[model samples]
Target: MERLKQITSLASLAVFRELYNSQTDIYAIISRFLNEIISTNGKYNFTLTEITNLLNDSFGFTIPEAVVSTSLGRLDHITKERDIFSVDKEFERTSNDVSSLKDMSLQKSSDIVDGLINYIEKKKTYV
Candidate 1:
């Protein structure tokens, strides 16, 4: 019984460690993706095909176009303060936010805090 408990505890610790590492990696990837999108803002329009190619070239992630589109949608949600899509009959991508990222510097600590807060709030709302 003692040996079993020890093994179980060790396994749990290992699993936790792996989970932590994976989360860190994911956060890093997301940050990199954000940076890439910020850098190449003017190159593409609202089309996901263009965005996917740009992202794949920049990050070497080769993420599916659908995933890139979804992330862009989430970015839109987070930065809703910026009117990215005009209310016109045809949806057009506004250039406001793209120019802003170029001018504004990102504060990593604040972003991490805000990201965590957003994640928690999303979880609360959904779950």
Candidate 2:
């Protein structure tokens, strides 16, 4: 009984760790998808099934809706605040430093959010 409890606890811990690990890539991809939607359609309302299908079709990987929702929580850009989309200030194909202030985000989402808002303002001029 003691060994069984230990095994179960360890297994659950591993699962949680995987879920909590660096999901930066997933967030970035989702952000890009949301941005494209906003740019073309002007709003986003992708249901869980739709997101699951999109991930499978676009990236060839299937993810649970719960996991995708958790990843989306890390995006930190898209919100109900005027439907603003936080985009990378400078997009570089080879750059992984999407967050402002390089790899370190001290002020957290505020900086990146500002950048995205500014980017949106510039985009408005073209529209």
State every prediction's TM-score relative to the real structure: 0.35, 0.32
Over 4 Å off in model 2, which ranges? 1-43, 80-127
**Which prediction has the highest lDDT against the true structure?**
1
Tell me each candidate's RMSD, in Å, in order.
18.5, 21.6
Q: Give candidate 2's whole-model lDDT.
A: 0.44
Model 1 per-residue lDDT at 99: 30
Superposed model 1: Cα runs more than 4 Å off: 1-28, 41-44, 77-127
RMSD of 1: 18.5
> What lDDT tens digits, residue by residue, belong to model 2 across residues 60-89?
344576666555555545332342323343
For candidate 1, give the lDDT.
0.46
Q: What's the CA error at residue 86 for candidate 2, in Å?
A: 12
